[model samples]
Target: MSTRREARVTAARAIRSHAEDVVRAALVALPPRERTRRGLAFHAYQRQVRTIMRADPVAFEVVETRMLAEGHRTSVIEVTLRGEVGVDAGDMLHVLWRNDLDRIAAADAVTAARFWTTPIPHRPSRWARVGASGLLESVVDLSASTDSDPARAERITPRFFTVAGVEASDVRLQVTHTAGMPPRAASFLARVRPGDVVEARVLPHPHRVAHDGPGLAVVTGSGAAGVFAALRAGASGIRLVWGLGDKQLAPWVQEELREHLRAGRLSSLRLALRPERVTDLLVDEPIEQMAWIYVSGHESMGAAVDAALRARLGESVLREMSDGLRCIVST
Candidate 1:
């Protein structure tokens, strides 16, 4: 007889396999009209397929499997869904399944390589344009503000975790791409093209300056949303801390930021490995002066940096934001 663990693994795999088949069948049977009405659900299942072709089986690697009380069992699977053209890099699918009474309760695709449990609603994208080194920018326009002048351009809300731009009455966004993206974010990236005039929503918020004093901006994967916010707010001194893996999009981004450094808009820029501690970037009197801080990056590293910043600078001075590995650290 097989061990209890063995039986659970086998059962979990079977459940996952059947679920994949059902999703595929549902997608194939979905007509154009039905897709329009239930596009959200159908599109979601379409993305769950790991292979490039719809006919291929979903490739799920069992990362971990565990048994629970009441005959319940859990399985964590790593899924990789490749795009026809391609994604930036490090894109894969992650999901958890609970098996009980021969039925499985499936969860939403976590989508991010890093652990980002929080889910945010995504508005339809107005426009999408691709830039250097696999950088995809999603644009959303708030159009004109009713509370303020219609002719005057409205500025984007400066939220630490999200990257956005507002110029000429347009709001631009650059989501930090990784190996695997959330279902909604991936679908947005896949369908968006330049000058398409798509529909999308704009997340609004109150804008605030980096801080009362000089600030240090630490970023990992984002295209420097915080830095732009700081400059727009007329920050005098700014620093950039960055890191990346094999797919280094930073070098291309650094060129754009260089002009700011040369123009004296930035005080300093440091590139370090993800494993390095945030405190290593501190130098001279800045540590003691209580500089305002922003840290953004992968959930794992970002959390570590946040902890370190809080320890070194305290919670009052440090700010952080991210959607999984998609993050932009800034002041």
Candidate 2:
């Protein structure tokens, strides 16, 4: 077997739901209006297999016209997942097999079905709507790192936990979701059946602590200011502004972020990479049904961050910002 497969097998065993952790964390930072009890009841679905980058890459994408489309609030990465070693037994290289889904679901998804969903992506989200299942996909992607070092997995777990903390904060059960969702909603999200240790204690976002969050919008230029404008007006919700992938963000800033991440102080992080494609490298398929999350990202480094956020999160829930990202103001 190649080293990539070796890495995949190694990563699949440990970090099975890396993307889910990110999605769930992103929800935590949404606007307070949307964080209500019922709002969160349905919104928690974002936490499951949704964020995992798909094995097969696609070219089609949705557009995000919201004002808060800054890259800071969202997570952008150049993840190089190894061959589908961890996915299934088939010798052929494609990894997104159904057997792998059944197995991981058995371990994580089945237990935590609340978080996991069929492969179909949700349509763009509306401000007032958080719908349920769209389709049933046998194929499942386990969010894991290709790194072989145990310490790397260990180090990354903290990132997952920190983001999970962001998910847990201020989330209330909205009557809309409660009335519309099935009876088992709370039971599932409170502690999904899957026995995954998805949560950790990371530092709080500076805005979460200082401003009594939802955190502050650290807007940079006109784009950022636009995002700040929408957010201040209550049209937008949780989001961030990202830095350049190569040189935009200084090295010192990256080091400080690492330290803060360890301390759980840095609520979010960003990297402005000039991606060849629109969707994030972490996710293989085009974004969908994740409209509940509101974020903004860079255009040059990658596809429009707001576009991805808007595609996942429908326009209704999105608030346009002066900056280039969309804001998640409500559930």
Candidate 3:
């Protein structure tokens, strides 16, 4: 996200709480001493990837930390880090030992040689981006009370994890390839069975700040991963609803974005917010990120609220739904 506003904490918490988790490769063993060099180096490499994510976490669909530095000439690891962000030679060896580093390509080579000459790290964790908006670029170590839930996401921890994209789909459509999709639209489509067609729309939010030609989009997916991915994919402005699922996180998001925009601290601003619902409609206005908004549930309910938002935000920008991510051409 741009320096335009601060990231909201409550919104973040809501999404984190409600997000569905799917784990991948839960077993990662620590590397031996000889591999320590590569381990540490790979750790630093992961740090570089983290920085790229910090810059814009969801820039690419998949950014393998191991493939970094090796010059994986042909792959989706679009972001690169060197100079300040990349690691040192000694640090590289440390990565070899961390078990975070693994060489997936090498057939037969000495562990030491792999440590020294290993261009890419060995079998590292999978960094796949799903849909959702309002993901922080960096991985923050937030102090979490264990009483809080940390669902099926054994892959990335809830405390250290940040929001990405809110978009979802079982059919594997590339929302990042285009612009963004609303959370409801994405969720509804994500429920589609294999090869099934569902209509989705990458509509521009009415109150949302627009770009010159194409207008902007407010992304909705499961977590901050989608947010990072959407931002990385070049969506103009985003509705950071995933992480900031409610108004508590709203101030945090606002503050963070404002700090980024003003290039100053907003601690002195003394802004306060209270989430209130008016007649079954949640109401918290005067907030900049979202305007005149009431999150509606499913189809019929969605239509009623959608009509209101459409009137307020504009029906023109609110393009009709699309066939959610069924082989749409990507740039």
Best by TM-score: 1
What would the TM-scores of all predictions be?
0.42, 0.23, 0.22
Residue 9 lDDT, candidate 3, scale 0-100? 28
Error of 3 at 97 (Å): 28
Which structure is stronger by TM-score: 1 or 3?
1
> Model 3 over residues 189-236: C-alpha lDDT tens digits?
222233332221121111111121121122221122322333433443
Per-candidate clashes come to 14, 65, 85
lDDT values of the candidates? 0.35, 0.27, 0.23
> Which runs in model 3 stand beyond 4 Å of their true positions?
1-225, 232-247, 250-256, 259-305, 313-331
Listed per candidate, the RMSD to the true structure in angstroms reads 21.3, 21.8, 22.0
Evaluate residue 136 in candidate 2 and report its C-alpha lDDT on the 0 to 100 scale.
Answer: 16
Score candidate 3 by TM-score against the native.
0.22
